[model samples]
Target chain A: MTDTVLATQAVREESPPRRGGGRNPLRHALLIALGVVMIYPLLWMLSSSVKPTEIIFRDPSLWPSSFDLGNYVEGWTALGAPFHQYLLNSAIIAVGCIVGNLLSCSLAAYAFARLEFRGRKLMFAAMLVTIMLPIHVLIVPQYVLFSQLDWINTFLPLIVPKFLATDAFFIFLMVQFIRTLPIELDEAARIDGCGHFRIYWRIIMPLCTPALATTAVFTFIWSWNDFFSQLIFLTDQDLYTVPVALRSFVDGQGATSWGPLFAMSIVGLAPIFGFFLAGQRYLTQGIATTGIK
Target chain B: MTEPDRSAPPGGALSLASPPTAPAPAAEAPPAARRRRGRRSQRAVRDGRVAYLFLAPWIVGMVVVTIWPIAASLYLSFTDYSLLRAPRWVGLDNFAEMLGDERLVSALGVTFTYVVVSVPLQLALALALAMLLDRGVRGLPFYRSVYYLPSLLAGSVSIAILWRQMFGTDGLFNDFLALFGVQGIGWVSHPDFALGTLVVLNVWTFGAPMVIFLAGLRQIPVMYYEAATVDGAGRWARFRHITIPLLTPIIFFNLVLQTIGAFQTFTQAFVVSGGTGGPSDATLFYTLYLYERGFGSFDMGYASALAWLLLVIVAALTGLNFLLAKRWVFYGD
Candidate 1:
């Protein structure tokens, strides 16, 4: 009897029918139409990247009169700074940020989550307050500081602070994930004569792989897409990231190459999309838990 | 170091309590057992030092990078500190100038309008899509991945480039419209429509919020819906009474985050306006204006002031959100 009631509850929850079956089909059709509308620009961009300049403006709807791979080749060479150099620069900064964040954030998160220390709650709240502080406010002084240290035009300004527990959002995320772990594991490790650091490394770090992966993926994406910072710091053409390099393709004067610019953009986004597809499960679950909390 | 005599009278008496156990002979006793144990305890104390040792790199980075830069920025906002020379003391000049600047006023207006319009529209679209996907739909994961693809590529330089094309005069949007005998205007170049194109782009990447909404919807008890259904509540009535109220907190979360994000929008404006805030500076956002002043005009002092003003505006908006959430957000607990 209870089973039947529970089954009915599930069915009703899944499908709560309203008035007019006639209206249902209309709503469904409208949703599909909206989805296509949302995706159309992306499809159009993909289609435009392969078309020749004539067809680009003339026959915009044609998939391509012929497959022209020249656009990618020309775009890559026309970057002034080699396209591979920009990709290399982006990779170095992103990887450095990921490594830094993983080590520092996880440690800070473990302390905040499990350790009983003086001023722990206060420190955590201070970290949270930093999130509200806009990055724009700090840019001028940060530039001055880097200039003084002779660090301008280098990746250090972009890559080094991340080694600190600077991004409080990710730290808070790690803290919450650590809190959900069973405390009995810590107690058992302690009983076996394991110290706090040992317990964290041997037990907690291993279990927190999914959270770490999420943080790494997000940091990689953010670092890769960072435009303003790269523009400000790296003035030398050789040190430019992909975004800055792509911007250089458009002369400030009248000349603008739509075909090559679009082509480079497609190439630039390939790695990020690939990364997202590979680790999307962890990313979704991480975001869900983070938002719900 | 003399060891404790295990065969002594008290040791023998202690062992006698357990008949199966016998005290070790004194001749076989180690000479420094107590000393060794004392040394081992000291070693354990030394081993406890590793925690701070492992954390030293982060502490150094915090002091030199994060903490110092923030302190310097706060101090620099008070002084005339262009990059070429040493900063000179100037009290409140930057802030006072900002109050009278018409460009700053218009930039703030544009930014607030962008935030106010884009955030709610984005969240509403996200919630609607999430609800559609929550119905045990077939190919749920595939639909989700497709919907989420835009967000993954949302803030890239490429998306901005793509947006420029899609909204251009002779671009695909115009072509699509021409089929219906409707002529299209230059969406990116026209001052009236440039900001609107950005808002549409902001709204298009509603995947992150939608995913969050989907998770929140999943947590609402199925029994509540069943009870409402059994009471003969219609679909619209059930959603209005139960879904919206229960989902308010998550909606509030998305509002605060998206508003902050929208205010910091720089990429689309930078790329679309070709980094010049073209056609009478209509696409000049707060951050874009900041970039122009600091980098374009080389006025670091005024830009620093602008940055602080942005910080204050964001803080005020967030504070307002927290104040209002109490009245609307329904916590299940």
Candidate 2:
């Protein structure tokens, strides 16, 4: 859902030019300047994280003269619970979401795309409309529901809906991907005495690697970065995800720990950065195709 | 009801992969086997049952998590529910109260301003960058990837903290401004500039739309540019006549999507304003206000009303975008 490239056909022929030419240097120079401006904050964060707390404001230079590792050590235990615990919590949520979304969404997508069922079209349409229903509308009622179920302060509120395939976006993405696949494979399998479930598991699922990868990457990132839900539900300090834990450092206290906060901030962003770097292609590809199709 | 066809379509690859759970076919049965196997009457019912089985999780979730909450919230909007007490019916009271609530009014104003200022700016920047990148730049994907990084970090608490620090009175922005002998205000704490800083933040994440714009730009046939050049059309003419017209659909799409997103913006304002949506509620986004009412003050009923109000606004805006798009958005079909 990130971007929709309305006409992918237009740019397919033009490979990125390898050799530089007239005016290219100026274009490169302009791009370089913009890139520096864009990336400076991240560099500044990295610089500030290593700088001594006293010099952080005074030394505005991105390349800090002094390197202090104390911030990293201090930030770990800054919020009573160790930073590793928060990372572990985020990891658990992300992993749960990935597994749940992959399994449930793909199952539902298969039904919508391949299987003929009563109310299939109607159900699919209903799911599409839900995409427009803002998360704001659900926040209050969901909070109340979770509280009433006595599931507050636990991962259940965060993780349970994922297992139920509540994310229609991914389901729609997988359905689109599944439809593009050859139906002849299913027919051949059926003739060979393969049942629907067997065909789904062996034939369809195997062929949907790209779509599944996109779903997994997005689910992991979104779940890991989900602050609002985790913040509301997991009131316990120990159960806080990375984003929630990061918020505690900047809770408008009298004496804010800027150094450790910046340090932990870098640490918290590391996984997402790493994930993006690893799955950058798939992430953009997913976003590009998911909505447009 | 459609039946599952047993035969493959013409020109299909007949090479079948090994199926994990394949059942043994009846070797001796012929016409009876065909009758049993070709039971097209049962196929529709069987497929329907299996489809539901596969869709079970989503069906349950739709009812339990999504539908129920939406219905409950709609009901709660007309009630007086706090977390502690059972909801009492109060028809139109909550909505009526919103008419006079100064903070809620300001919150809506702040949110509308944020969306108005940010979405277009972000999309403009995105389209600009995309046009530049579409010029057969070397390592285009690499540059695209780098630009997209900011969007990945956008709306994170860490980024908000970093933003506040960067824009503080004695922060990096001020220090940078010192080189030009200009004094900078504490952008986050200053009411006049707090919303501006958040707007800057929203604009910084233009990478998402930029990539999409790049795709849209790519969709514009190079032949159009070539033809324009043959007619002695300059760069600006070609862009105005060809690119803009062709890219309108994407522009419209991004506008609608980004508007909805900007309207829902909460984390940036929340974290920047220290979760108070202040320096005098200057940065109190509608979502943040709803959150504060629902969680901070435990006024669930009013919050639900506010939430529904947001949904209505977004839906109306989206609907309007579609109606307006008819005048401008050109599909190449």
Candidate 3:
């Protein structure tokens, strides 16, 4: 970042932009310093996950003298059940959400983006409004409703809403994506005697892969990391998702085992970390596109 | 619903609709043209039905999940609804209770401080770093990914746990302070500093805004900057005059989002303070208090009221920002 933007920006405005690629070591120093500060905690945690327990905090140097999987082994079974059970629970919810968002949201989005329908404008506006409605307002009533339906302590409450296309944000994202596809494609399909469902399944779905991937990845990550809802819905020890189980790690008496705690925390974050690495293009690009008008 | 509307006044509608246009479909046009017209109308009618079919899931979700719950939440706010028993209406009591609630006031204070202080700092860092990364730089991808990692992990319990220990008495922050011969207090436990640490934690995850700002900067046509440069505009002048005005919408977008998100922040405060929002209630965020009231104590009615208040505050602030944005947020058009 030496040739980066900062070049005594406040004082040297008159300096030619870039200074002919001159190395502004000072700018590199600043960014590097901040970057190190930004990542130090994570590095420390990663390092401690492998290091012995006695010197975990005694040495926060982000380097391990010993390569030990002992903490990981201990953390896995430290809870009554193995920690992977929580990971599995989180994965089940994530998979359900991903499938739900992809199927239901894309269908609704195709209608909004390509079809002519009565009440389309009104429905679109309603969907947008739900985007801003705080989840808190819906929480109490939803809890009550779910409890009445006998869905408490079950994944149904967490997973059912997605099947109904309740995650309006994804619908909006897919709508934006589908709208960008040429209308001629749909017209061409219609000329071939294809109906709306056929066109949605064949023409539009194939073209909206990026947007669909974005929705799927986001749903996976959000469901994987979801807290308040899961905390409320899941009470049984066998049903705990990664986030809830990790919180239990803190609330329980074994929280003092810092090494195991950090190890399990890292385990919990693994899938999300992997998804971020693999689908970062979708993640960042999706926000860039969806966030703007 | 759409299908019924198309046929509700069947004979009168078709007769009334057609006479003014064609007089008689059978007699007015050539056979091919008439067939095409008939097919097109059929297609139009089918579109309405197909639209509803496509929208079926969303309509159900909206009705059963969102709309009903919103209504129920409003109703619950005015009642004494405990899970163990039936709801008993007590109009205005929940709202009145909030007015006199000390912890609610303090919670509001804590929430506002977090929002006001953290959101701006986060956006400022985001924008500044965005500006830096906007210019052609080596290893841009590396830096972007490194920074964006936190935002991905920001809401996760893992990060929250990391944050707690990072600010604990023997945590890394204090250890850093130790290098300077400075005796560091337990930042997460100190009443005055608990919220501040959370503020810093919030700022640490400014990556999403940074990425969005970077994208918005890229969208500005290069011609604008070049034109400014030719006009003897210094870097400062170009940035201040050209960039700020153009990027206002993105800035406003990030501001509005960060503020709304900050108002609802739960995980960090919850995990940091061990779900107590403690250190003498110094870190008791509004949602944390709501969680305590609703789930911890089963004050469902009062909790609903608090939730509604949150909704109102978020809506008001967002609306106010939109109004304010007209003066500052410039559309490229």
Candidate 4:
């Protein structure tokens, strides 16, 4: 049945290409053309990062004239601290958010999906409203609250919220996923003397690997790429995440370091690009099934 | 809060089609229907206890992390509070000031223009590509991954940075135009074209909505298309008659979600315009303006008021879409 999911992710299913109009070659030609337009900017950046600074714009060819490795080396230390410091900061936050979303969102999802507790429907509706609420409305007061707590310039303001399943989107995703599992498994577990916690922890969670992976992957990407909150919170240079550090380069040392900036831009995008190559299935199916970006 | 452009929102919109608002996702429903064995007081009590135990962190988080901030923001919007000062009661002053604020009005105009222009273009591209690819292309996954790559990273600082360079005076765009002996202005720095570049950037990442459209298209039984063709319907006729009506829900869904996402754009404008929304504020997105007010100047009260304005605008627009959706969004029984 889950193979139906594989089908929807668009490539894994072995469904035959629709047979019609005898226009297969034309379709293939158009796709290749569009694909090149889609990927050109990225390829340009990748090549420009390795090109000599003076020739970056002059040589518009995607293949660089000279494969200079200086940009990567220079950009590494160009931001005052080494680039790895920023990456490490981002990694710490992403790991914290992933573990937080997995643990908190799953528990909430289970309650919403299977348990018939009092106020479950009401709580679920309230959670949905949270999803619809724009973060702009909350950021000011949240900044105020964090400042009052003296949590600004620390990852506490960023990492701590996820521990509470504040990301209702993941909870909503997991609830939809958990509802698909056969209830007979829970019924049988109940008959065998398993309680709700046991059924949730042992039975349901093991079956939710796909949903968990979805939450984890998205948490990492969003946290790693997140700018607004991070920009506001991490003003101290030492606490800068990748996004903040990248912006600083644009602000302070932009003109002389075009090549280095592109290098760092490539560096910032690599983990996610590599992540896409690795977890393409999870990323696409996550969107395809959830009808989300 | 998760970034606006990625996956945080729109996913919420999908839940509108799911439980609490509609029937359960039709798996194991019969057993759930038959289970009158539930609702016994002892079982109910035990279930509630266990469920709350599992839900402890989420419940606490919801109140402290989400609800508290929302309530505080609403309250803050009504006061003259700056950081390090007591929040002075100034009911309606902040709202009153917004009317006379030129930057606020410019921000509103810029945001509305962005939402109005970029969304339809993006969704139209998405629907067009989805239709083209849904016709069974070879390497569908490869095409999808290549296309979807930008949507995933478009919200990042790197992409925004690249966008700035791509339109800079000596950037690749001008270089491309140079080949035709046509003079290319610095698009990123040009007030006339700064927001246009951003609009083009939004339209470029049509892959996300396209993927959703593909999934929705798959849900349409091939037999319908087959029958239509057998009855002598042409390709355009089949799409107009069959595909259009059936695809309306997905179209409306993308419209609302994308509109909301576009309105919240900050990183692109912040980066492309060098945190000034400059070239004379042509690309000053509303969120960018809000960030400038709240963080740049530390005007928490006015910023909070601006935040509420954004929330209401989004909510009203979403409400309006649902109302308009009834006129056109179709559901097949």
What DockQ score does model 2 reach against the true complex? 0.40
Worst 10 residues of 2 chain A by lDDT: A1-10
Candidate 1 runs further than 4 Å off? A1-31, A251-255, A291-293, B1-64
Tens-digit lDDT track of model 2 for A97-119: 89999999999999989986545
Lowest lDDT 10-residue stretch of candidate 3 chain B: B1-10
- The numbered model that scores best in TM-score is 4
TM-score of 3: 0.90
Candidate 2 residue runs with Cα over 4 Å from true position? A1-23, A252-255, A291-293, B1-44
lDDT against the true structure, each candidate: 0.75, 0.82, 0.81, 0.83
Error of 1 at A214 (Å): 0.7
Scored by DockQ, the top model is 4
TM-scores for every predicted model: 0.86, 0.90, 0.90, 0.92
Model 2: per-residue Cα lDDT over B213-249, one tens digit each:
8777766657788888999999899889999998888
Candidate 3 C-alpha lDDT tens digits along B226-296: 88898899989989998898788778878877888788888888888889999999999999999999999
Candidate 4 lDDT score at position B270: 94
CA RMSD of each candidate after superposition: 11.3, 7.0, 6.6, 6.5
Q: On residues A1-293, what C-alpha lDDT tens digit does candidate 1 reach at each position?
A: 11112222232233333323333665557666877877777766667678775667777654677778777877788856668999999999999999989988888787667764323344556666676566787888788888888998999999888888677667777777787789999989989999888988999999999889988988888888888889899998889898888777754312256777777888889888888889887666655654311
**Model 4: residues with Cα > 4 Å off, grouped in runs:** A1-17, A21-23, B1-41
- Is 3 or 4 the stronger prediction by lDDT? 4
Residues B1-333, candidate 4, lDDT per residue (tens digit)? 111212111122223222323323334547654354333434655666777877899888987878888788889889998797999989999999998999988898888998899999999999988888785566777888888999989999999999889899898899899999988989988888999999999998899888878877877778999999899999899999999998888788778778878888988899889899888889888999999999999889999999988988999999999999889978766
**lDDT at residue A71 of model 3 (Cα atoms):** 91
